[model samples]
Target: MRLVVFDVDGTLVDSQHHIIRAMTAGFAAAGLEPPPRAEILGIVGLSLPVAVAQLLPMADLATQARVVEAYRVSYMQARGERAAPLYPGALDCLDRLSARDDLLLAVATGKSRRGLDAVIAAHGLQGRFVSLQTADGHPSKPHPSMLWQALADAGCEARAALMVGDTSFDIQMARAAGMPGYGVTWGYHPAEALDAAGAALIAEDFHHLTRAIEDWAS
Candidate 1:
């Protein structure tokens, strides 16, 4: 089977606002100031633990733990009330891709299982992804565990898979997995940065994304 793995936060969902807001609350909970938005945004694709570490390098272990806890609580509450918006055409792209018999869809995201579950259920995207590789199970992006797991779950070889995402971490992970990576321009990372990271191609919109996949699979 041909497999496609997508990143959730920046690619499929525009979740930066919620993430940043919770992070700010987390800092307050830990009695530390939140990092600047640019600094926080730069580490967008890292898992929660990693992101927290990067954002608060001087924070002690106890403080870090407290911050993470607060972040989880804040994020969960906010997510229920207001989950991120799906990128334009993201749902449609999923729909088109999942319709093919030869294709197997899955997620490789830095989101927690709980977070991904919220999105899937909210968007009526259940069962559209055969497998989910969340931060809870393995090392986050820039690591190949998520992609590798998705390949195994989808019953496809790495070479037959494509990683679709919007960050350098996604491209790096795809590289490590020996899979082609397609970067989406509308996500967190700039197109130039994605290109520098060795993305196989960059898609400007969902139609372009679909065409690339169709061409690849054809």
Candidate 2:
């Protein structure tokens, strides 16, 4: 079966505001300033610790940990206030892709297992993904660990799988895993960056992305 692995934050859901707000809280809790909006979005696909470290390279481990904890708490609280919504055509695209018997859907995200669970619960996406690889056990994006686990879980080869995401880290990870990465324009990263990262196809919308996946499969 062909596998389609997706990134959650920017790829499927529009969580920019949620992320920015929680990041503000996290940095505040650490007595530091949050990075710029672009900087925050730039690190969207990386694991929390890794992302935090990038944002605060000079900070001590304790400070980074505190930031991570605060970000988690604030994010969860924000979730209770308003769950992140999927992109305009996200659900429709999922429905179409998941309906195929020969295709399997999976998620490879920097989000914790708990966070991923919240997303699934909120979106009524139970049993929607054959593989759910999260940051809890794996190294962050660009490490290839998450995609490796996902491929193993679905009994699919790397060449038969496609990674769909919105960042350079995702493309980098897919490259390391021996698969092609499809970049989404609406996500955090720009098309130029995705191209530089060696994305096989950078799509503007889910319709074109879906069609591109089909073409690749065919």
Candidate 3:
């Protein structure tokens, strides 16, 4: 079976607005100024602690932990206000991929398991993925552990798997796990950055993403 792994935040859904808002609130809660939106977006795929640390390089451990919690709280509040929507064509792509018997879908995301489950449920995406890996269970992106575990769970070789994501960290993780990475253009990172991070293919839209995956599997 061919296993296809996806990143959640930027790759599947457009949560940047929530992310930035929550991040700004979190920093304010900690009595600090928020990082620029571009800086925050750049760290979208890393686990919360790592992302916070990157955003506040000079922060003490206590401050970083506080920011993390504050960010979570702010994010939860934002979710209550409005659900983030899936990217255009994301659902259609998932439906098409799910129809293929020879393919297994999985998720490798920086989100906690609970967060992932919430998104899946919100979108009625039940049973769409065979394996799910989250930051709560593994190290952050670019580490390869999540992808490796996903391949193991799917009983698929790395060579038979493709990683789809929007960040350089995701591309690096796929490379480390011996899989070709497919970058999505509409995500957090730029196409040039993805190209430099070694994306084997880049998809500008959901149609292109679906075709690229099908072609790779074929």
For candidate 3, report its TM-score: 0.99
Q: Could you give the candidate ranking by TM-score, starting with the highest?
A: 3, 2, 1
Instruction: Give the local distance difference test score of model 2.
Output: 0.94
lDDT of 1 by residue, 6-52 (tens): 98888999988988898999999987888888777778888988889
lDDT of candidate 3 over 135-182, digit per residue (tens): 998999999999999999999999899999999999999999999999
Q: Which pairs clash in model 2? A: none
Runs in model 2 lying further than 4 Å from the true structure: none
| Poorly placed runs, candidate 3 (over 4 Å) | none
The 10 consecutive residues of candidate 3 with the worst lDDT sum are 74-83
User: lDDT of each structure?
Assistant: 0.89, 0.94, 0.94
Clashing pairs in 1: none
Error of 1 at 76 (Å): 1.0
What local lDDT score does residue 47 receive in model 2, on the 0 to 100 scale? 93
